[model samples]
Target: MNEIIRLEHVSMAFRMDLNRTTSLKEWMVTLLKGQHRHKDFFALNDVSFSVQRGDVVGLIGHNGSGKSTVLKIISGIYKPTQGKVTVDGHIAPMLELGSGFDYELSGDKNIFLNGAILGFNEKFLQEKHDEIVAFSELDDFINMPLKTYSSGMLMRLAFSIATIIEPEILIVDEILSVGDAHFQKKSRERMRQLMEGGTTVLFVSHDITEIRKMCSSVLWLDHGKIQMYGDAVAVCDAYQAAMI
Candidate 1:
C-alpha cells in the first residue's frame, strides 16, 4: 500500500483569552495596558502519523483529546501551527452535517449545491440525483426547505451526497449513527461497502467496538498526544486497559 496521508511533527495551537472581559471598553483597556491575558493552548502537540491508501483507520480518544482537531487539520479546515502535513488524494469530510447547505434552499437544490461543493460536475449529480435521494429515503421531503427538516433529516441528506461521490478519502466524525436505527444500519452498511471497494477512511468514534470492527488500524490519542498506533485489536486492547 502506498502512503496517502502523512504528518511530520504536526501541532495545532489556539490562543485562548485567560481574562473574560464583559465590556468592549474593559477589553480595550486591557489591550492598551498590555495586560490582555492570553495563552497558547496546544490542541495537537507534535503529533505524527501516516496512513496508507485503501486503509481504514480509526481515531479513538476521550472528549477534548484533540481527535477532532486532527480531523479538521487533515480535512484542511485547519492549518497546523507547526510541522508539515501532506495528503495525496481528494478528501470528502463529513465533519459537520449540512455545513455546505443553504437552509433557505429546498432539499433538491441543496443536493445540487452540495454536490457541486464536493467538486462533482452537474452532469454527474444529475445522473446520481435519484440514487442519492433513494438512499437518503427523503423522497417526500426532497422539495422542502432544509430549515424545515429535522437534524436527522439533514444528516441523512448530507451522508447520502457525501458517500455518493465515492471519494478517494472519506473523513467521518462520529456520524455512523446519523439517523434512526434503520438509517443507522443502512449507513453502516454503506460505509462497509465503501471500505470493501477500497476507499481510504479516517474516522473518529467513541464506540470502541465499532472501531475494532470496522477499522483495520487504530490511532489512539490522549491529551493531544499519540498513545498508540497499530493493529485494531492491539491498540484498542491497550487503550481499553488504560481506561480501566
Candidate 2:
C-alpha cells in the first residue's frame, strides 16, 4: 500500500503568556519590567499515524481534543512543534467556514483567488470555473460581493471550489454541517465521486453516524492523544459508548 500521509511522534505546543499586553506600549513596558511569563499547552502529544492511498479516515474527539490541530498539520497550515509530518500528495482542505475568503470581493473573483491559493493556475481555474459555479448553484449571486452571502452560501461556494479539482488528499474539518440538508447530500455525493477516483480523505466530524457511514477507519483523539484507531464502526462505537 502507498502511504499518502504520515505523522510520527507529532507534538504541538502553544505558549500562553501570563500577561497579554495588547498594545505595543504595554508590551514594551512589560518587557522593560521583566514580567512576561508564559505556560505551554500541548495540543497534540506523540501522535503517530499513517494513511494509505484511497483510505477514508475519520477523526473523532471532543471539542479540545486537538482534532483541528491534526488537520492543520496535515494541511501544512502549521508546522509540528516536534516530530514529523509527511504528505505525499496535494491537499485540498476545507476547514472552518469562511476561511480563505475575501468578504469584500465578489464571489466570482474569490473563486479565482482561492483557486490560486490551492495552486491552480488561471487557465485551469477558468476551465473548471463553470463546473464549480454549477455545482454551487450560485449562478445568480456569483458576481455579488461575498459579504452579502449567508453562511450556507459561503460554504457552498467554498465546497464547490475545493472539490472542483480532484486532489490526492482531501482534508475536511467539521465542514459537513454547514449547508442545508439538500446541499449536504449533494456534497456527500461529490465526495463519494472523489473517492471513486481514488482520493484519500481525512475527515473530522462530531457526527458519529456520518463517520461510520463514510469512513473506513477512525482515529479517536482524547486529551491530545490517540485513544484508539482502527475500523470505523469499532472505534466510533467505543468512543460513543464512552461518552454515554
Candidate 3:
C-alpha cells in the first residue's frame, strides 16, 4: 500500500494564560516578577501514526483529548511542537464548517474562493461547478450572499464543495453534524464513493456508530494519549467497555 501520511512522535502544546494577559506588556510584567503566568497544555502527547492510501481511519476521544488537534496538524493548519509530519498527497480537510468561506461574498462566489483555498485551481473548480451546485441543492440561492444563508444551507454548500473534487487524503472533523439527515446521508454516500475510489480518509467523530460504519481502523484517544489503535470493531468495543 502507498503511504499517504506519516507522523513520528508528533506533539502540540498551547500556552494558557491564567491571568487573562493578552498583551506583551502584561506578559512581560508577569514574567519579570519571577512568576510564570502561562501554563503548558499538551494537546497531543507523543502521538505517532501512519495511514495508507485507500484507508479509512477513525479517531475517537473524549473531549479535550487532542482528537481535533491531530486532525489540524494533519491538515497543515497547525504545526507540531515536536517530531515530524509527512504528507505525500493532496489533502482536503473539513475541520470546521465554512472555515474557508467568505460570509460576505455570494454563495456562488465563495464556492470558487473556498475551492481555491482547498487547493483546486479555477480550471478544476469550473469543471465541477455544476456538479457541486446540484449536489448542494442550492441552485435558487447560489447567487445570494452567503450571510443570508441558513446554517444548513451553509453547511451543505461547504460540504459539497469540499468533497465534490476528490483529494488524495481527506480529513473530516465532526462538521457533518450541521446538515439535515437527508444531506448527511448524501454526504456519507459521497464519502464512501471517495473511499472506494482510493482516497485516504481520516475521520474524527464522537459518534461511534458513524465511525464503525465508515472506518476500517480506529484509534481511541484518552487524556491526550492513545488508548488503543487497531481494528475498528475491536477498538470500539474496548472503548465502550472502558466507558461502561
Candidate 4:
C-alpha cells in the first residue's frame, strides 16, 4: 500500500501561564512587574509515524499522552509546533462531538453547515440529508436546536455527517461508544464496512480489545512520546501488559 499519511519529527507545544490572574488589571500588573511566567508544554514530542493507504491504525495511550493531539494534527485542526505533517487524501474527521456544529441552530441546518465544512456542496448535502437523518434515527429531533439534544443525539448526528461522504481517510477520537449500545454496534459495523472498503482510518481509543480487533497496526503513545509502533496484536499486548 502507498503511504497516505506521514508525520516527521512532529512536536506540538503550548504556552501555559504559570501565574493565575483573576482580572485584566492583575494580569497587566504582573506583566508590568516582569513577574509573569510561561512554560512550554509539549503535547507531542518528536513523534514520527507513517500510515499506508487502506490501513486501520489505532492510537492507544493514557489520557494526556497526545493521542488526540496527533489526530488533530493529521486532520489539519492543529498545526505542529515543529516538523512536517503530510496527508494525501480527503479526510472526514470526527475528532470531537459536535465539533463543527452550531448549537443554536437546528440539527437540520447543522447538517448543511457541517457538510460544507467537510467540502461538500449544498446540493450534495441536500441529496444526502434524508439518508443521514434516516441512519442516525434522529428524524424526530432533526428540526430541533442542537443545544437541547443529549450527548447520544449529538454523537448520532456527528457520526452520520462524517460517514455519509465516504472520505478517503477517517479520523475518529474516542467517540465510537458515545451512542447507545445498539448504535454502538451499528457504528462498529459501519466502521468495519469502511475499513473493508479500503478507507484509511486513524482513531484513538483506550479500549485495547477494540483496538486489537479493528486495527491492522497500533501506535502506543506515552508521555507525549511513542512507546511502541508495530503489529496490532504485538503492540496491544505490550501496552496491556505495561498498564498492569
Best-to-worst TM-score order: 1, 3, 2, 4
Instruction: Give one digit per residue, the lDDT tens place, for model 2 in 1-244.
Output: 9899999999999888888778999899999999887788999999999999999999999999999999999999889999999999988877864477889999999999988887889999999999989999998899999999988899999889888988999888877654899999998888889877899999988999989899999999998999999999999889989999
Model 1 lowest lDDT segment of ten: 91-100
- lDDT (CA) per prediction: 0.93, 0.90, 0.88, 0.90
Instruction: For candidate 4, write residues 1-244 as lDDT tens digits.
Output: 5999999999999888788787999899999999998899999999999999999999998999999899999989899999999999999888775678999999999999988887889889999999999989997899999999998899899898888877899998887785899999998889889988999999888888889889999999998999999899999889889889
lDDT for model 2: 0.90
Worst 10 residues of 4 by lDDT: 91-100
TM-score, structure 2 vs. true: 0.93
- Which residue pairs collide in model 2, if any? none
- What order do candidates take by lDDT, descending? 1, 4, 2, 3
> Worst 10-residue stretch by lDDT in candidate 2?
92-101
Better of 2 and 4 by TM-score: 2
As a whole number from 0 to 100, the lDDT of residue 57 in candidate 2 is 95
Model 4 Cα shift for residue 208 (angstroms): 0.8
Q: What is the lDDT of residue 231 in candidate 4?
A: 97
